[model samples]
Target: MAEAIFWVSFAFVFYTFAGYPLLLMVWRRLARKPVKRGFWQPSVSIVIAAHNEAMHIETKIRNCLELDYPCHKLEIILSLDGSTDGTEEIARQFESAMVRVIPSLVHEGKAAALNRGVAAANNKVVVFCDARQRIHPHALRQLITNFSDSTVGAVSGELILVETESSDDDTSAPMGLYWRYEKWMRGMESDIHSTAGATGALYAIRRELFRPLPEDTILDDVLVPMRIVMERKRVIFDPRALAYDKVACCAEIEFRRKVRTLSGNYQLLVQAPELLLPWRNPIFVQFVSHKLARLLTPYFLGALFVSNCFLLRGFYLIPFALQFAWYALALAGWLAPERQQGQLASRTAMVGKSREFS
Candidate 1:
């Protein structure tokens, strides 16, 4: 039983990180269908959900106004969910015929604000974004073009992490690497059938398909797209539709963000249990293999370590030693602040140089 538990743990960890991507690659090769793209201009309602974003709300409104899509075809909605920090005032400054400000006096959370925005939206295609990120000028156009394909119900934009002085520091570079890996996997998943979820930074969905989420839904980004996927519609990733945001300022902020996200995954299962039912959710295998398996990885990792220690005999001895060395290296790396600081600087320089040429 100990041996069996150890292997299950080991296999789960491997499958979550390595095997899923490999399987996606094979699936894409076998079933990839290119989304029909063209110069199609559709009316879009860009919804910006703001809380206490007084600092960035004005800039975000300006960014929306500057998008390359036709002014007549675009409607910008700033949904302010009780901001004492003058976020609503900042948003109101930009309200006009095309721009609308929907403000609530009480803090009702993002999902509630989004539902209100969707209700206020005049167009069928509603693009959701946050106040913190700047969408690229052509992102709206690129996102809308995906709708030319009838199969696609939503298109998620690429979110590029802009390196800042604070974000380029040691504790955040790994987050950047992880995000890049995630984008690559999302692209693969899109090529095969659909992306499992949409990036909250920038994503567009059909307004008619929009379901009002619970007031406290933490992963609106994930839940919204997955709900569309459940209805046999494709949720695709479009790399050309780009947005930029600074990475979480520090490790603590990033940790909190991740905790909220992981907790939302659990919340999603509770809110939409049918997602795990294979017949109901078309991408059930992908959902379980990609999203749910990741939630189990930490436990699997812990179980592997604990189970391996009890079987330190013959080949088990080698496995135990290797696991010890692997963890030791991770601990050493975590402890070496100076080394990581230098590496961060080097990485920033490399990224800057690459961006200059690209």
Candidate 2:
């Protein structure tokens, strides 16, 4: 029983990070469902949800206005969800026919802000973005091209995380390396069917397909895209549609993000139980492998470590020592958090240098 438990836990840990992606690679080769992408110039509405984003609002609005898309075909909406700061003031300065502002008197969270902004969108495609990222000039052009495929209902843009001048030169830090790996996996999943979710920093959905989110909701990025997937429409990733964001100014920021994501996963299970039912969700296999498995991986790692202690003989000893070393290194980093930022993780192949906040 000890050996059986040990191997079961070990297999899951391995499968979560390595086996699943390897499976995706082989599966796509066997049965690839490619998106029939072509040039498309649909009138687009860019929606930004914000609260106390004064530092980034002005630049974000300008970035939206300066996109390579036709000015006559585009409109920008800023959903100001009760900003007590000068965020509303700065955003209002740019209000015009091309730029619209919707202000609320109380803070309603990002999901509610997006609900309001998207509600006011009049264009065929609504491109959602955050305040901090600087989208590429042609990102809108690249995103819309995927909609030429009749089956595609949404398109997610790639997020590239560049280092600040003050940061270390090594891009192989834990956050940087892990993020690029995740995106690479998402791209593979997209080719097979639809991505598990869209990137909140930049992604476009057909306005008509839009569903208003709960005001207190979390993980709008994941919830919105998966809901679209439930409608049996394809949600694909476009690498050329780039949104560049600076790495988090602090290491603790990443930990908070992880907590939010994990919490949001639980919220999703309660809000959309159909996701777990294979008959209801068309992408159930992908959802289980990509999202649900990820949520349970850390516990699997814990189980692997705990179960290995009972079989500490011969070959089992090797894995036990490796696990010990990994945990010790993790503990050391936690004790001395300063080491988290500049430290180098093992070098590996990277897609684009990218990371995400939502």
Candidate 3:
């Protein structure tokens, strides 16, 4: 029974990390449905959700103003949610016919802010972006091209982590490596069918498909797109549209952010139970394999480790050693210092750090 449990958990972990992506690769090659992309600027409303984003709000506004799309057709809405940090003051500096500032008296979180921002949008297409990232001017243009296809409802722009000049720099950073792998798999998912979700940093949707999220919502990126997918429209990915930013420089900060993200995934399962049903969610398989599997992986790893302890006679010893090695490598990656300018490229490990290896 222990052996059976061990293998079962092992298979699940393997499937979560490897087998699912392999399936996507074969699936994409067989059923690649390319987005019927075309070029033309439609009227767009850029909705930026800012909560005490005083540091990045001004830069974000300027970034929106420089987009390649027509000035007359574009509107920028700064939705401020109870920012005590002068975010409202900086945002008010830009209020005009082209820029609209909507202030919320209380800090209700991003979901509420988004609801307000999307409600104020005046155009057919609403582009949602975070204040921290700098988008490529052409990214808006690239995202708009997808709207030309009537079937495409939401489009996710690529989020690129700023990396060092040395290729070996990212090998020690776990988050950086994981994000790139995730993006690659998501791209394949988009090719074969709809990607399960959009990147929160940068994405666009048809203004009419917008749904008011619960005030406590998390993972708005996934919820918004999946809802659109439920409406029987394609939620696609376009790498040509780019948003650039640095990964969290501090490991502790990144860990907390990831924890909040994981909590959001749990919240999603409760708030939107229909997403698990095939008939209700158009991308059920992808969601189960991609989002749900990942949310459950850490628990599976625990089970795999515990079950392995009961059967450590001969062949079982190999996996036990491998598990130990895996944990050790993680520790080493965390303890490893970032390489200085003149250091050798091979100084970093391979598993945890992503941006350095990017």
Candidate 4:
């Protein structure tokens, strides 16, 4: 039973990170449904959700105004959620007929703000963007171009992490590697069926398919697109539609952000219980294999370590020794000098990225 528990936990962790992606690659190669890309123009609404982003609101508006899409077809909505800072004022300063400012009287979080902005959208194609990132001029055109395909319901753009010379090497290095790996996985998922979720920084979806997310919902990016997938419509990841954001210089901030996102995964499962039922959800296999399995990984890892301790005798001895050595090296890497530590993290991240994309 001890060995059984150890093996089960190990298998869970391995399957979640490594096995599922390998399976996706094989399946995608066997059956690929590529999006039909063309030069198509559709009425699009650009929704910006800002909370106390007074500094970037005006600049974000300017960036939106300069997008390569037709000015007549493009509408920009700046959704401000109880921002005490001059975010609303800055957005209103645009005073352009193309830009509309929606200010929520209270701090209702991002989901509510998005719901309000999306509700007021005049166009069928709703493109969600954040205040911090500057999207490429042609990104809007590239993203909406996917919708020219009748089967496509949503599309996500690639977000490039812009790192400056003065950026923190420790966090930015690993993050850059991870982001590349993430983009590759998303592209693969899109090719196979639909992306697991859309990127919040830059993603477009059909207005008619837009279900109002719960007020308390986090990870709107994942929830919205996954819901689209539930409707048996494709959600694609378009690398050509690129946007840029500064990498988080501090690990703590990134960690907190990830924690919130992970928690939202759990929230999503609760809010959309039907997604777990294979009969109800078209992408149930991918949803569980990719999303839910990852959420349970930490517990699987803990179980593997604990069970290994109990089964250290006989045949388990070799495996136990290997695990001990691995942990020891990991600890040593963390304790090494800053430069060496950063290098270790970068190497590990790149190795994972290479394996995923290879």
TM-score per model over all chains? 0.91, 0.92, 0.90, 0.90
Local distance difference test, each candidate: 0.89, 0.86, 0.87, 0.86
Error of 3 at 72 (Å): 0.7
Predict model 4's lDDT versus the native.
0.86
- In the predicted model 4, the residue pairs found to clash are none
lDDT of 4 by residue, 69-132 (tens): 8899999998899988778877788867799999898999999999999998999899999998
Candidate 3 lDDT tens digits, 1-358: 9898899999999999999999999988888988888876889999999888888999999999998888999999999999887999999999999999999999999999999999999899999999999999999999999998899999999999876453334442666888889999999999987998898889999999999999999899988998999999999999999999876544544556779988988898898899999998888989999989988898989999889989888999999999989988887765666533213222232222343323
Better of 2 and 3 by TM-score: 2
**How displaced is residue 294 in candidate 1, in Å?**
0.9
Ranking by TM-score: 2, 1, 4, 3
**In candidate 3, which residue ranges exceed 4 Å CA deviation?**
163-172, 331-358
Residue pairs in collision within model 1: none
Best by the lDDT measure: 1
Worst 10 residues of 4 by lDDT: 339-348
Worst 10 residues of 1 by lDDT: 349-358
